[model samples]
Target: MGVMNELINRQNVETLAQVLGEAAPGSSWGHVAGAAAELDGLSLRARTDRISTALLADIRLMPEPGFPTAARTFRTALGSAGFTGWIIWPVSETAVTLALETGAGPDPAGDFDDCLALLAELTPRLTGEFAIRRLLDRDLERSLRVIQGWTGHPDEHVRRLASEGTRPYLPWAVRVPGIVLAPEATIPLLDALYRDPSDYVRRSVANHLNDVARNAPALVVATAERWLAAPDGNTAPVVRHGLRTLIKNAHPGALLLLGFVPASLAVTGPRLDRKSVALPGELAFDFEISNTGAADARLAVDYVVHYMKANGTTSAKVFKIGALTLAAGETRSVTKRHAFRQMTTRVHHAGVHALELQINGIRHGHTEFQVQV
Candidate 1:
């Protein structure tokens, strides 16, 4: 089974049912078991929703009246499941989502605080990011305060949440308007996690900074410069990954920071294996470069393909080929193959496409190819 399948399988729901049974013996495990049986016929998302719905009903059957009490009850039940660390994350995620969807009352702020605290203890398990995003929509300032405090938490998971939860362009989660509009607010939390002792937390911090870099390159460049000046072993990787987007975009400041100097290099013989190819085919090409300059040069070589769209327009997609250093009077040859496979996120249209080689962010050579259906 795939990872997603393994995560929300029949067995997981059964385990959850057992835990709930252990938590509140008076509750109906038969109902929970019946719900788990229905999951095998549904998709992953449907399974999650069904499980949450089933768990909520079971919790209601317990003595608890409010969501806060129910969330605590679920967490306590989860502890008895014999699953250590993050293996039980999905269960916690489902419990938290159930709390958020069905538990909010007149005191939303108070309810949100309770949920946030519960998430901290149970480990958000990848669900806290979106949950926090929703909370941000309800109360930006208050939610930010809660998230900011998480940055200093003793638990690395909570500290990671401080950055991950506030990412402006977090994938699969609703965007936080405040952070999207003014990302500078998140700088303090990013700074706190910049040199985090845990690699997991550092990765989240780096990704958060990368999201910030998309909107504010100058800010990221400045931050990278500062971090690099007094860098430790762990901090170095964070800065490098944080600047990945800018570096891939060939931002001048990013290249300079990474020691890749922009220099006029000679590119020759961009030879294609064939001038034309059909959809779902491969395009192979080779190119050579020479360092005509008098000094050693570090170069980032990338290729941009201007794909033809259905509307008779073209969209450019950049692909990184290779990065190398050439001594003065040295030459090198590189070859690459690009597959025009159909992608769900992209539609392929038959038309003449333009390919170009970029050296140190400068377009150096150009070629054309035809893609047919």
Candidate 2:
């Protein structure tokens, strides 16, 4: 990798950029030989040199817009350069970005430790399936140590990067590496970022927690329940997203939190709106339920909110208020609050959105209304 430094020098960027400028998108190949030569020149200087600086220089200096062509160039250059490990792993971002975008997949050029080392280098600059795959490739126990340490990086981008980059089944990103399939492995990482001060970061935290919700609802429910039972602003949404599917399944605890019981459950009307509320301000939804159960059952109703971004699609999240145990056969009146206030992270929108309330494990028999933003 040291031999490759020659190509990474300031002079190489100028040459590579000039080559790319002179050649049209599909015609950049003419420069590959020259660039590869420049890299090889550097490799000769060191016995350990596998990649030439020229190749790295070419990669870093590759033209941006011709995404596909540049991707091929990087892949070929990396293979030719004999990329051993992360000593050059800072280039993982460049390579992975191209590989991921080109749909070429990973080559795993180096040995096992190289994989972990690569993650340690690139996880901050690159994330999503890119990070997850590499992290999984590394020793699970050791990789986790790296991830745990990353949560505290002074740079919040890296911190937020830690969570968003690890989402299993992250679309437009790679899928989970086979080993850490279960959500348990991801818990500490999620827990650490749950209360991030940045809503941008928190939203990633919610999505990731929800990803966990898909696999281990029971555990996530406990996580959410823990936060619900206690009172913490930052953890509420995370807990809710983690518990959403469970709430829909009418988990006893989830139902209890959403407000459902034998008595006091009101003759509430359905939520009939298109499910969109505007953001940049605050949103509040108030509902009353009358419990009509004969025996004493806890009332817990959980709500799932689908938010429409300006882009014309929707993203979802879950929110929990509290749990109430209804008195046997008594008609208890319960009120639930849903807030979409500014500064709380999950913002609303001006497009079509939908909200669903799961009562006793089913969409309430009534219609749900769409609220104005």
Candidate 3:
């Protein structure tokens, strides 16, 4: 795949200029065209912001130059041969900038509501999730009240945006502290959207619930419990995904909700193939578990890697293994290989690292190994 910065490159900026210039013939789009060279060395999000800033200058040249005028100009360009793809990211952002910079009228509420409508209209092309943060931070209640209404919208993209845009910990999006402070504010939207007909919308609801779990574990559990109580065929997976973080942390409620109850099991060694591993290497391990109880047991088996951080502290991350039902008096062995390679998301430290097995919220068989990076 191409790097993220390529999403908003010189070609995209030039295309945006042509579309916007055609939509409003009188306005000069040279400001946007000039921003192409400035995108070099910048990250994806930075390029988006730079293009939006350039578009703002050109938007001011339009007649009555404001958010309403800019929204109409942009709407006019939405056709078969109009601007689309990543270029629309900056266009939507420019709309947000103009709305926030210049109020619609004396009534701020009117401007707020209208800006939201514009975003909803633009979201079908490219997400307005990131740009919606500015409004959420400005007045979360106002923005949410509008977004809540979006849950029932016919379009799946709008429905997904209703949940994704308001996530407390939305990735690559601006932080909305109000959502974190009041985690319950977005729960109703999740409640309305968790059973959406579209898988795309349902996934966003699951992610939104997961984001809420970061701050309010109890609240997330409660919400998930409600979902489970009145579940459809797809509800289980959604709850599992939504509660993944809590499950990794061994939250009792999350464990129980997923039916991974504590069980008596005779566990054997998580024997490592090698005690020491070199850089860009793999470590093979195997573990055996027998259900010692009178009844069968459901297992949520996972492997934990306590990675040594730069500060000499270890951070634990859980990697999932498949779940299975263990019959009474039956033993099963599982063998897996873990690769310790260089990755942008994870940095390997040359020191002692630890591995352990976790089943149904219970940890077992701690093992230490040396990593040479």
Could you tell which candidate, 1 or 2, scores higher by lDDT? 1
Q: Write the per-residue lDDT of candidate 1 for residues 170-270, one digit (tens) a residue.
A: 98676878888887888988877788888989999899999999889999999889888877788877987898878778898998998888765789957
Q: For model 2, state the Cα shift of residue 335 in Å.
A: 18
* Candidate 2 error regions (>4 Å): 1-132, 135-139, 177-180, 227-231, 257-263, 266-373
C-alpha TM-scores of all predictions:
0.88, 0.48, 0.96
Runs of candidate 3 with Cα error greater than 4 angstroms are: 102-107
Q: Write candidate 2's Cα lDDT for 107-168 as tens digits.
A: 42333333334444444333323534654544467556766777887767667767776776
lDDT at position 152, candidate 3: 95
Candidate structures ordered by lDDT, highest first: 3, 1, 2
Candidate 1 deviation (Cα RMSD)? 2.9
Encode model 3's per-residue lDDT on 1-373: one tens digit a residue. 2498898898878888888778877778988999987988888888888998888888777668777788788888886365777877888888777777755546556767888888888889888898899999988888888999999999998999999999999998989989989999999999999999999999999999999998999999999999989999899999999999888889999999888998989999799999999989999999999999999999888999889898999989999987879998989999999999989899999898999999998999999999999
In candidate 2 the C-alpha lDDT for residue 190 amounts to 73
**Model 1 weakest lDDT span, ten residues long:** 81-90
